[model samples]
Target: MTLLSALFRNQEEVMTFHSRVKLSAYDRDLGLFIVANRDDKPSIKPLRPYQMLVLTTKVKVSDTRKWVEEVFKYRGNTELLQQFMEWEIPKFPVSGHMLKENGVPGGKRIGLVLNKLKEHWADSDFTASSEDLLKQIPTVLSELDIPITR
Candidate 1:
């Protein structure tokens, strides 16, 4: 069965994706508008290719209303989901439980490499997604209260 079918197998197992699309208006017929007039007349420049992004995911429909709600969970925005679609399902990131605190880099790409190393070192019984280990990361971060500046 398809992945979508699998995700929605039972209502209990289903994860809802509340997708939102915003498209800009473009006048396709405006061929002459491209010709720069010597008069320097202001013309409506067509918008670039419309951005297609999924705004949010929700277990309950109302969760999409405010993204910052305490318990709200979401999977991706448009760019994130687009990249996720391209990712190979077989390749899952490793949890960095086994690594030293110094091992995780300040950058995301380095962190990914560190995760790959963790995956390689994982034992037979150890699933890469150990919840106990995952929980520790945030706990440690919270203790440090590291400011994440965009």
Candidate 2:
């Protein structure tokens, strides 16, 4: 018999193998890390690209969420927080990935960096030009000890 038949002696085994293969494929294609525990067995889930980057930068996931919440609390604007959650936060992973790809520094204190960005954006009278915003990026990066690339 083939490798599949050799590995799965019965119909039940064959089904289980197929199910696992499908789940693994789905996870790989979608950039998702989902875990399901079955039959008292531990499930292993690999880290996603962005998650790995975050870990490498030594940023705690809880700290990031706390910073987001603190900014929301400081502003006391539900609508603005909603917009940030709906729009900006989702883009963070993609942005992080791009920065990593470009050899940009990943600072250890990502929470502080995020808080600064939030403060800049939250200012009611703040009207920074695109160039001004770009300049601020390097400043934040420097504060985080992330090397500035030309």
Candidate 3:
């Protein structure tokens, strides 16, 4: 059976659908999903795990924007904060429970947290190397007011 079928075999309703089945590969390492059925060829798709989570969970865009502004106040760099919010934040695998614990009532809160983490890792030195920044992820999360537990 194809990957998608194998993954959803127990979902009778989904399995019975008559439309052409689409195949997508989820990359755990990258936290991304690649759609393979487009034009009968596999292509890199911009499906992030957090995007899926956000879709299933209700998120208020206004709240998210407000959180972004709050994060900007803490981080103090509009350009970097915006980039971090748009790109890095969505890559984080966040759950409803985690969001609630972190005072992130919606996607905006999550974005704020992510931006905070990014800023924390930067340690007031925006020129930090990539390797150094990556190593600080866990520490930054732990130090945050609302810790992120795996």
TM-score of every model versus the real structure: 0.18, 0.27, 0.22
What root-mean-square deviation over C-alphas does model 2 reach?
15.0
**Candidate 1 per-residue C-alpha lDDT over 1-150 given as tens digits, one digit per residue, 9 for 90 to 100:** 122322333432322221222212111111111111111222242110011001212222232212211111122134533443453323233444433343333655335444333333233223446444444454344444443222
The global Cα lDDT (0 to 1) of model 3 is 0.38
True-structure RMSD, every candidate: 19.5, 15.0, 16.6
Runs off by more than 4 Å, candidate 3: 1-110, 121-124, 145-150
lDDT of each candidate versus the true structure? 0.29, 0.40, 0.38
The segments of candidate 1 whose C-alpha lies over 4 angstroms from its true place after superposition are 1-100, 121-123, 127-150
Model 3 per-residue lDDT tens digits across residues 22-109: 4222121111111111112222422222222332333454444333334333334466345436753323333345544544445554
- Badly placed stretches (over 4 Å) of model 2 are 1-94, 98-103, 107-111, 124-132
Clashes of 3: 1
